[model samples]
Target: MSLSKIKAPLALAALSLVMLTGCGKSSSQTSKKQEFSWSTSAEISTIDMSKASDTVSFDQLRNTMEGLYRTGKNGKLMPGLATSSTVSKDGKTYTFTLRKSRWSDGSKVTAKDFVYSWRRTVNPKTASEYAYLFEGIKNATAITAGKKPLSSLGVKAVGDYKLVVTLDRRIPYFKSLMAFALFFPQSEKAVKKYGSKYGTASKYMLYNGPFVQKGWTGSNLSWKMVKNKYYWDKKNVKIQQIDWSVQKTPSTAYNLYQSNKLDALSLDSSQTKQLSKKAGFQLINNGGTAYLQYNLQNDENLANVNIRRAISMAIDRSGLCSTLGGNNQPAKTFTSKGVMYVGNSEYTSGIAKSSEAYNKYRKSEAKKLFEKGLAELGKSSITVSIMADDTDSGKKTVEALQSELTQTLGKIKVETTTVPFKTRMARREEGKFDIMVSTWIADFNDAISFLDLLTSNNSRNYGKWSNSEYDKLIAASKTTSSSSDRVKDLQQAEAILLKDEGITPIYYISTAYLIRPEIKNVYNDNLGGWQFKYASVK
Candidate 1:
């Protein structure tokens, strides 16, 4: 299952204040006209991807909104709405020439459109959960904190087709960041006209990418993305429309796929074996890590390190993975393998030393840790609340963990809480629960995206886990020039984090989608989950 489906409620709730916001099925009434239609397990919680904090809706919106740049099949960056760009000698400034583009409404897309959108997102009043994505952008942090005015933000529109951006430092993966939904340009007219209703549904906003949304009820179970006539690359863009519906049941999605009513669907653990033999069944590796996060700030027993370590040791990741599904490997690091690169070098390949002492898999060792923790805290029992979305895998994992904890950790009571994707996200931000199941998808191909959340101030820190030394290493590595030196620094930082048991590492998630052979140029990246540009159904 996608992380967004599990954590959608809480993530959406986190953006509830400034937000204006905003799934699938198949039908076969077809002609020779090339059209691509797919179904997600759940409907998108919001359509305003720029302000979105979750990954699921962001992936869909990436198909609708063109960013400053986009990623190609090779993982290299390519121009999206920007026709060309120039970088200054200092590597701190970038100037982009925007392609002639128009909104679905026939209004010309202008430089001011980007300027207004960037300012609105970073505005302190907006309270965008994704505001931190603009860290390197000059004065963005200060402007978002209300220490400076919006005019001081590092972006400026030189003309109707020119955009100039200044950064605090040179970012290697900066273009990939621009390809994400958080950086997609928004219109000032749309925001003001809809005011609080912006991005609520298909009609709430305009599109500039290959597809424009239509026939969405905002709160309903269905929506569609029609080909955008005003898109800059309309000539090469295929797929006239994409029809989507929401089916929360894994069985239903599988049945639809089998009946040829749906072109693609995800497999549950039960369906994995049976469907692996079917034609067009292939696994798309998406470097994602799934794990349980402890709300250390709330629970007294969980606030102690030994107890947290004990819980980590008790989890049988191998068994849990078997129960969940195939095409997944147990994770030992927060940033999974193939997640980031250091000049064609795997970042953690050399530095993550394999030692049984820190491996955290022994049940006997876990019991010892739990007993020691109890003695220190003077408590006989520990009750932990495990929060998850209301889904099959969510329920299964929670049950498995509960059983493991009860059997391994003496006198432990594991309570379970299940809610919709949006509500769970709200509870996570307010620190309303104890331990929860969660995953972080990379916003950019950088280890810092994973490591920075443990910093004390990140609002995304649901666990309230903190380590000053880890923060120092992550900060230093970001500015370091030598690739080898930076990799070592990151590895050292991961060592400290794992030793501290900041979060339990489960397994890196891989995406499983069944696509028609005729579908061309559909690409996904570790940064944005997926992008639909260059895709054609023929």
Candidate 2:
């Protein structure tokens, strides 16, 4: 999922702050009597799993939807709708035994829900951006490409409670992938009833998870997630209601936190530094990488490898991170650190030395390379604009990049444009910018979640960077049975991507937040996406 910029709404008003402050009862004992208030910078773009592409929407979906498995603390797979699953010996087939569950509307959730959901997402008419994620499932790629019928997409409802899935090849991370919101089951009855209006707002959707969303009007900046009575695990749910609001400015959100109006506040760079020692402060490692995506197809200057490399080397990533703090780390590769491992070490560690030259800041070398690239293109100089969100942090990021590029690369002009988060995302998808500042959080704890986006055929490869060898290595990594061989293939692929400067890795993001002391069980998945399913306010 992509990162987002904040939008402001009026402060949530007149809500009771139900707190239990007695000595006899433990925090857990009083949890059910409390409500939690949370803040987000962005609005929910869409609740429809097939169309939701931003982190905000995905996080909200996780709260109200149940997949086969739910991602637990540290990326552990916890059973949701599925009680158990068995894989075929060749690893090409999986059969799941679903537990008895009921949707918020009191409809039984069966294997047919899974079958319908999968088919709907992969159907060519659905135009789902996430359909590419179903690549390994048998005929999924072909179905999405309109080369095969939707019924041939390899998933079936064996019975009311049993579901089967066949894969075109072995997928090592298949189980983890199921934890994503895109794999969640949808109610066919609700979808058909609502049709085009489905998932546009909370009222149009059905929930089978721990919570049922309400008060969302699609474009509204506030909403509520109330405990779902029909949920199978409702007895274990503590928080009775979660009030969510959007606060565009960090200071505004911080004020709400200080006044007890909010249970949590996401901090920006300045706030992180100012409140580092605060009691409720936390630094969350968001297993994602922010980078500069060059428009190779439209921008002739950016099409030159030397120019791309020069732009990459011109920016001092360490300085940039210092400017925009929150414990951001300079990225040496596109994949974030700690997502994958090779032998006893992290995968990024293996390629550190090889990637140093390209990632390191060297103004003189960058200028030389920039000049040579201009000469090769038969131009004296060139101007390029960088686009980013219009929020405070987004402006800061693009300004820093502009300063670095113009100062380091002589005779080059750098421009900047800041738009709303949604607009920026749309422009990026259309390849409408010279360089777009993009952030990608891993869908799972695997390097492929980041690497596969830049593949030639990937729908997310907006920059249009293509390399045959890179594509081959990525394809091989997916099908290889040997764990060590897969690592080697991925490592070599990363090296090629860096050498060619397909994209300029900026920094690894670590978000800072101030969470109330009374809030408990709130945690993040392995990929750093927040999880509040089990959260409670004491």
The best candidate in terms of lDDT = 2
CA RMSD of each candidate after superposition: 4.0, 5.3
**Most accurate candidate by TM-score:** 2
lDDT of 1 by residue, 150-230 (tens): 999999999799999999987656776776667878888888988888888888898888888787777776677778999
Worst 10 residues of 2 by lDDT: 7-16
User: Each candidate's lDDT (Cα)?
Assistant: 0.69, 0.78
> Which 10-residue span in candidate 1 carries the lowest summed lDDT?
13-22
Q: Estimate each model's TM-score.
A: 0.92, 0.93
Where in model 1 is the C-alpha error above 4 Å?
Answer: 5-31, 342-346, 349-359, 518-520, 526-528
Candidate 1 TM-score, C-alpha based: 0.92
RMSD of 2: 5.3
Q: What are the per-model numbers of colliding residue pairs?
A: 20, 1
